[model samples]
Target: MAFAWKAAGITYNRYLAIAARVVRRSLKEGPRLQAERRGEMDLRFAKWQNGKQGENKSLGEANASAMAEQAKAE
Candidate 1:
């Protein structure tokens, strides 16, 4: 069984983003501001190798770059 988003030719991440945006827009002004702030991806991640963790990097940036690479490949 194929997912609806897949049938629509949209990635799962893009579908979730659209759903989140719709939910945020449906909120009242104050709560919407809070929700928008909460949606901000200030995430950080580190690569682990040999039981050692590398320096932290922005997860958002990494994902963005990876998506760009995928787009290029496609």
Candidate 2:
């Protein structure tokens, strides 16, 4: 069986990119400022397999990268 998103034909990253865009657009200035800062916090995910944490890239970086990729594809 295919994954949920795969079955729907959208990758998880694409889903997240769309969601982030919608959320950012929905926020107003007061909360948007706080949210953007929260978004910029460098967070890393770690699973036991590699015994190493992932690189420190902010959500802003990921969002920017996704936007850049979409821009290039257009």
lDDT of 1 by residue, 1-74 (tens): 99999999999999999999999989999999999998877879999999999999999889999999999999
After superposition, candidate 1 runs with Cα above 4 Å error: 11-14, 63-74
TM-score of each: 0.60, 0.37
Q: At residue 25, what lDDT does model 1 achieve?
A: 89
Q: In angstroms, what RMSD does candidate 1 have relative to the true structure?
A: 3.9
Error of 2 at 25 (Å): 2.0
What are the lDDT scores of the predictions, listed in order? 0.95, 0.75
lDDT of 1 at 39: 86
- In terms of lDDT, which candidate is strongest? 1
